[model samples]
Target: MRVSQTNLAGDLLLNLEKQGAGPLHERVKRALRLAIREGRVEVGTVLPPSRQLAADLGCSRWAVTEAYGQLVAEGYLEARSGSATRVRWSNAPDTDVARPSARQAPAARFDLAPGLPDLRAFPRRRWADAVRAQVTQAEFTELGYPPAGGHLRLRRLLAEYLGRSRGVSTTAQDVTVCTSVTDGVRRMCHILRAQGITAVGCEEPGWTRLRQVIHAAGLEPVPIRMDHGGLRIDDLAGRPGLRAVLTAPAHQFPLGTVLVPERRAALLDWARGVDGVVLEDDYDAEFRYDRRPVAAVQGMDPSRVVLFKSLSKTLSPALGIGWVVAPPRWTRQLHQTDQVVAQPSTVDQLAFAALLESGTYDRHLRACRQRYRQRRDTLVQALADQLPGAPISGIAAGLHLILELPATVDTAAVVAAAAARSLRVADLAAYHATDARAAHGLVLGYGNLADSGLQEAVRHLRGAIEGSS
Candidate 1:
C-alpha cells in the first residue's frame, strides 16, 4: 500500500505529542507502536525515509532510527537492507474471500421480474467518456456539493429534452432533481401532506414501492379501480378528500394499458375540479415499440400536474437520478425543502447533461428500444409456441409484458415453481393495492435476459407453469 509520506510524518508527530515524560527514543517508539496498533499505519505501508521523517518531526535521526529498529524487533515493522521501513502488523482479520450465503432458494439464473431494464444494454463507453470529460473540464465550484434541487445544467437540459421529446411543458426553474422515482414520490407526499391533503389515489394494481412510500409518508393511498382504458376517473367520485393521485399515464405498470386521450383530459379536469394535483409517473414512456411515444399528460395542464421521470430504466439504476416537474405552488415548497438537501454529485449531473446535449442519450434510447422490442418478440413467440392459449398484454411499450394465466392456475404456485428452476418471476396479485383477485398473471421482463439463453429460459418457464397448473 502507498501511504502518504506527509500524512505519516504528521500522524507520528501527533502521536509523539501524546506520549508523556519519556526519553526521545522511547517516546518515538511508543508513538510508532501506537500508530501501528491503531491501524493509522496499515500493514504493507512504506514509511518515509528515517532522515526525511526526522527532518519533518524536528527530531534527531538517531531517535527515528532507534524507534524503527524497536518496531522491527517487535514485529510491527519490516526493515530490509535495501528497503525503507514499512508497517507489517495488522489488527484487522482477513476478510478478502467471499463465502456462500445460507439462503435455501437457488440463485436466480433468469430474471423475469418487471421494473428491470436490459442492464447489458447500458451505454458504458459513452457514459464513461462523458464522465471523464465533465470531471476534467468542470469548474472548481461545479465540483463542490450540488444545489438542493440539483445541478443547474442537468435541470436545464432535462427541461428541454422533456419538452421536445415528451411534450412536457417545463423550465429549469420548475424541475427538482431527485435520486429516483420513489424519492420524487416521497417528496411529493410530504408536500401534499403539508398542503392539507390527507389521502392520495393510486391505481388499483400499481407499483407496490410507491404505495409503500405514500403510506410511510403518513398519507392514505386510496386504490382507484382501473379498467382497460386505465384508471377509472369515475372511481375518484367518492374520495372527496383525495386531493392528489399518482398514475403512470403513458403505460400503467402491471397492466401496461395507456391512458386513453379522453380519459387523460377527464383526469386533468377531475384534478382541476378538486383543486388537486396529478402526480404523473412518466413510466416506461421512453421504450415504446409500436408507434411514436404518447405525449406526456402534463403537457395538457402543467399548472395542475407534477411530472416525474428517472434514468433508472433508460440508463441504469446505479446512477440514481430522476427529476420532477412541479406546478409553481409545489415547486416553491420543494425548492425550499431541497435547499437543505443535496443532490447527486455535480460531476454526475453535468456528465448526464452532457450525454443529453450531445444527443448520446437519445441515440442510446433508440438502440434500447430496438433491442428490447426484439427481445420482447422472441419471448412472445416462445410463449405462443409453448403456452398457446395464454393471453399476454402490455407489449406495445416498455421492457415487460403481462402473461395472464388461466383462472384455474395458481399464480403463486407458478411463481414458486419458476423460482425453483432459477427463473425469477413475480405474481401479478402482489402489485394490487386492494383486490388480489382482480388480476392473476406473470409480469415478464425480457430486458436483461441473454438472447442466446432466452429460448431455453422460456422452455423452463413453460415447464414450471404447466407443472404448477
Candidate 2:
C-alpha cells in the first residue's frame, strides 16, 4: 500500500520542514513523536507505509522503517507483524513524573503591568512578509549553521541603525547579537570577570533581571541608589573595588527619570577616573513623549561603555533578538565564551534585517507610539479626574508610568486587593534589588491597553487604593 502524499491530521498542518538539528532518520522520528505528543496525530491513527513515506520524502525506505521502529520501541507508536503503525501517545502528560505544582494566579481582567508593550499593535502582516522574504531570498550560506557572532547582514544593518538612530559608535565587527538584554549583559559580565572586575554597581530600584544576570556571571552587583537625577555617582566612592556599572540612563526603569546632564558628565568622569566600564541598557528610549531625547551613554564614550538593546518592548519580546555594542576589547571576548554558550538561530536574524532594510520596523514604531500615546493620555485624564493630585511620575515617556499612592495606603494591601478584583498593577518595591525599598506606587503600563480599557483599569486601580485606605 503506497501513501504518496504527506500525512495530515484533520486540519492540522504538519511541517516536515522543521526537522530540527539531527540526522535524517532521527529528525523524521522527532517530528512524528512531537505530532503524537501534541495531539495533532491522535491515538490509533495509522501512519503511512514506510515505502510510501520514503518515496514522498525522497528518502530511502530503510530510513523511514528505522524511524518507525524507534518510535514503536519508545512506546509513542505501536506496530505488529503485518499491521500498519498506529500512534500510542496520549494528550495527557504522565502523572508519574513528580513535577512540582504551582498555584496558578488568577488572570487579570485589566492588566497595567509595566515592562510589557501592546502586543495587539504588533505588525503581524509586516513581520510575516519579512519572514517570507527572508526564507525566499536569503543567501544559501544563511540557511546553514549561523556564525557565533550573528548573520553578517543583520550585524551590519544593526550597526548602521544603532549608530544613525541612537548615536552608538559601533561597526559590524564590534556587535554581538544574542537572545535578550539579559543575555547580552550576562555575556558582558563574563567578559568583565576576565578583566579582573569582581563586582559591579547596579541601580538600586533597577531592572530585577540585571542583578540576577550579574550574579549568574559570578560577579557581585552592588546596589546603587538613584534620585530624580538618576544613579548617584557620589555613592560609587563608598563601594570598594567596584569597577563596572549597569544603568538605564536614557529613561531609567520603573522610575522613568532621565539621567541629568550634570550626573551624565559626572558618570563619564568617574568612569575615566576609576577606569570603570558602564553597561548601558537602551530599553524603551524611543518612546520619549516629552523632553529632549538624551543620547545613549555609550555615545558619550564608546570605549568605556557597552550598549544593549532588544526588540522586546519596541517590536515584540517573542522575537528574543537583542544586540550588544561592545568595545574592541570585549568584542573578541564574546567569541571565546559563545563557543561554550550557544547563540540563537540565524532565521529570525534574517527576518529582522529584512524589516530594518525595508523601513517596516520604523513605521511600526511610529504607529505604536501614536496608539500608546492615546492610551496613556486616556489613563492620565481618568486618574486626574478620579483621584486628583495623585503623585504620578514617569509619565513623560515610555509605555508605562508610575502612580504613587498616599503613604497611608499599604502597597501590599492595594496589590492584594487589585489581584482579588482581577486588576493587575505592579508595585515599585518589586523593582528594588536591595533590602531597602524604593517609592511605593503602581507601575501602570498603557501600551497593550486601549483608551477605553485604561478608563476601566484606572477605575479598578483607584478602587484598590481606596480599599487599601
Candidate 3:
C-alpha cells in the first residue's frame, strides 16, 4: 500500500525546511497544513505514503506517520488502515448550512439579472503577484490588525485615483476605507443617526438592498421618484428632518440613468439648503460605453456630498474593499466611529495600492471598458434582431439596460416564463418602492452574460415574452 515518489506531482512538494524551527514531525504537519490551506493540494487528494514522503523529505518514517496521524485527528485529513491518507477539508468556506427560505433560491442557468461584472475576467495572476509583493515587502508592524480607517497608503492612492478618474476632490485625510457600498451606506446611516437624523431620501426605482440596509440601520428611507434625467429634486423639497440622501448619480442602479447637469447642481443645492449630506454610491460609473463618464457630484461640493466607490464593479466584489471620501467633518466622525467595524486586511489594502501605483488598475479598466462595450453591443444587437419595435434604454452606460415591453404584457408573467426557461431576468416594477403596474419593462444585464450565448439567450427571452404576453 506504499505510494511511490512519481505517484504525486512534485512528490507532495512540502518545504518542511522553511517551516521555521520545530520538531521534525511538527514541521511536516505544518508544511502539509500550509499546502492544504493555500489550495496547492485539493480536497480528496491522496497523500504519498509515510515511507515515500519521509524518504522525499529526508526525514524519519515516524515523522511522516505522526504528521499524518495528527492531521487526521484535526479533521484536515482522513486515514484508514487499508486505504491511503487523503485530504478531508477544502479551503473554501462552508456554505451548506440551513438558511432562511428567502436566501435559498436555485441559481438560473443564464443569469441576465443585473448587478454583476464578468467574474471570468478577474486578474487572478496579477492580483496574486500584488498580494505576494505586499506580503514580502510590507513592514513588520503592517501585518497586524489594519487601521480602523484602512491602510494610509491605500487611502492616499485612492484619493489621488478618484480625483483623477471620477473628479472627486478630496485628500487622503478625507478618505475612509469601507467594505462595500452596502457597508458605506450602513456606516453613513449610523453617522446620520448620530446627527439626530431620522429619515434619509433614496431613489424610488433604485437598489432595493441598500434601501433595506438603511432601514436595518434604523433610518426611514424616503422614496424619491426618478425620471429619465435622474432623481426628482422636487421630491426633496419640503421633507422636514430629512438631512441625508443615498443616491447613485453617475449611473443609477436598475434604472441606469445618469443625473443631468442641472439635476446634479440642484441635488447639491438641496443638500446645502437642508445642511444635508449626499451619500453618493458611485455605482457602475466606470463602464460607460457611450461617452466620457460623468464627473462625481462630490467634486462640485465635497462639503455636501460623501462619495462612495468600490472595486466591486470594476474588479470583483470578492475583494470586499471600497472607500468613502467625505468632508473633513464626516471623515473625522467616520474614523472615530469605526471601532467595531471589521476593516479589510492591511495586506489587501497595500496590494491594491500597488496595483494603482503601478498603473495596472488603469490598464485593467481600459480592457474592461473595451470588453464590456462589445458585450453590450452584442446583446443589444441580439435583442433588436429578436424583438423589433421593443424600446431599449439605459444602454448608453452601466452594465444593465432597460427593455420597454408592451403595456399589455405582464412583467411578472414574463419573469416567471424566463425563469421557467432557466434564463433569469428582472421585472422593472420590482425596483420601484410603490406599485409600478404601468412600468412594463425588463431589466437585462450584459455584464456577466456570456458573449457566445447572447443570441440564444435573446431568443429564449423573446419566447418568454411572447408566451407570457
Candidate 4:
C-alpha cells in the first residue's frame, strides 16, 4: 500500500496505510523503525511530541507511546522525561568489543597527548601521609559535604600560591574551587547569561573542546583570531554585546605564544572599554622552557579578568582540581553557582593543600619543568633535523609545539596516515572555525614522551607527512 508523506513542523512525517496488518501498534512501530533506519530521522534529531505525533497519525497516544517505548528499549531512541525523544546513533558496534577492561590494558605508556603532566612524578607518598594526618585529626563532621565554594584552607592556600607564582592578587573569598577550567567557564557562562549576556569570544585555533562547551551552554562562540603573539585584540574591538572573552594568555593553547606586553595592554583596554570580562586560563604557565613565565593578565586588572589554573598540567589530569579567582563582584555569584552544583571532592582538595603546604609541590614543579624543558628542546631538535624548514611555533612554553605545514599539505590526510602508523597527533585545522583562515599544522606534545620515544615519534610524523603528500 502506498503511504502519504506529510511535512509537519520541519520534521519528516511518515504516513503508513493499513494493509492487512495484524496489529496497528506493530505497524506503527515498524514504520518508525523504517524511517529511522532510512536516515529520515537523523541521530540526535528530536522527534515531535508523542501526543502531537499520535494526533496527526490518527492513532491513540498509546500507540505512539508504545512505539517510542520499543525504540528506546532497542536503543534506537533516547527518551528523557520532560524532554523530547531523540534518535540515537547505533552505528558503532558494541564498544566493549574493542575497549579493553581498564585492568587488562597495562599502564599508559608514551603519552604524547598534551595537557597531561608526569603522573609517575606525583608525590603519592607525601599525599598519603597528608591524607593520614588530616583524617586522624579531623572531626567526624569534616567528612560531610564540603562547602560549595571549597574548603577554606585549600582556598586560602590557592590564593596565596597563585598570588606568589602568577602574580594574581586574590583573597580566599575571591577564589572558588571548580572541577576544572571547563566547569568554571560553564558556571561563568550561566552567571553571564543571567545578567543578559549570551555571547562570548573564544580564540581561533584555540581549545576546540572548550569552544564546543561554550556553544553547548547555549551561548554564541565568536571565534576571535590568534597570531603568534596570542589572541588578536584588534579583531575583538567594536564587537557589540560581547559579554565575555575566554583566553589562555599565559601559554596559549595549541599555539604557545605568550600574550605580549603590548597585546595584553590592548586586551585590557578593549575589555575595559567594552565592559567585557576576560577569562585568563593560565594553562601550562608553570613549564616555560627558556625564560621566566609571563605573569597572568588577571594580575594586571583583577576587576576585569577571571584567572583560572589547574594542576592537571603540573601534576596529573586525574587530579580533577582547578581554582578560579574572580573579581569581588563575581565572587558571590560563582560561589552560589558552585553550591548549586556539588562542590569538588574535599579529600583531593586537602591533599593538594597539604602538597602545597609541604613545599613538595613546588619541588616537583621545578624538577618537572627542567625535565620538560629538556624534552622540549630534544623534540625541537628532532623536528629541525627531520622536517627542516617546517615553521615551529609555541616552543617557548607549554609541553607542545605547533609544526606549521605548507598549505599544499592536507592536515586531515596527514592525520589519517599517522593513525595508520599507530601515531597519534592533533590536526591544527580542527581547532579553527570553518571560515577561519588559520595555518594548518600538528600540535606535537613532548611532555609525556621519553627522549627515545620523542625522537621516534618525530620520525614517524615525518614519514606520515611524506606518505600523505
For candidate 1, write residues 1-469 as lDDT tens digits. Answer: 1111244533543356667767877877887788777767666777888887777667888988998898889888888899777777776664222222376445588888877787888888988999999989998888777776888888899999999999999889899998889888888888888889999899989899999999999999999888899999988967877789999999999888999989999999999899999999999999888899999999999999999989888888889899999987777677666354456678889889999999999999888888888889999999999889988998999988999988888889999998889988888899887754566789898877888878888898898988987
What's the lDDT for residue 427 in model 1? 88
Backbone Cα, N, C clashes tallied per candidate:
0, 1, 0, 0
> Candidate 2 lDDT, tens digit per residue, 293-317?
6789888899989999898998888
Off by over 4 Å in 4: 1-110, 338-341
Stronger candidate by TM-score (1 vs 3)? 1
Taking the tens digit of each residue's C-alpha lDDT, what string does model 3 give over 1-469?
2222333633556676678887888988898898877877777778888887877777789998999999989888888789988887775666222222455688777879898888888899999999999999999999998887889999999989998999999999889998888887788888999889899999988888998999998999999888889888988986877788888998987778889999999998998999888999998888888799999999999888998888888889989998889889877778766567787789999989999999999999899899999988888888889999999888888899999998889989999999999998999988888874335799998778888777889999999999988
Candidate 4 residue pairs in backbone clash: none
**What lDDT does model 4 reach?**
0.80
RMSD of each: 6.1, 8.6, 9.0, 11.0
Tell me the lDDT of model 3 at 406.
87
In candidate 1, the residue pairs with backbone N, CA or C atoms under 3 Å apart (3 or more residues apart, or in different chains) clash, namely none
Worst 10 residues of 4 by lDDT: 92-101
lDDT on C-alpha atoms for all candidate structures: 0.85, 0.82, 0.85, 0.80
Candidate 2 residue spans exceeding 4 A from truth: 1-107, 339-342
Best-to-worst order by lDDT is: 3, 1, 2, 4
TM-score of 3: 0.79
Expressed as tens digits, the lDDT of each residue in 95-157 for candidate 4 is 212334567765433445566666667778887898788888766877998886889999999
lDDT of 1 at 326: 94
Top lDDT prediction, candidate number: 3
Q: Give Cα distance to truth, residue 333, candidate 3, Å.
A: 2.4
Candidates in order, TM-scores: namely 0.80, 0.78, 0.79, 0.76
True lDDT of residue 133, candidate 4: 80
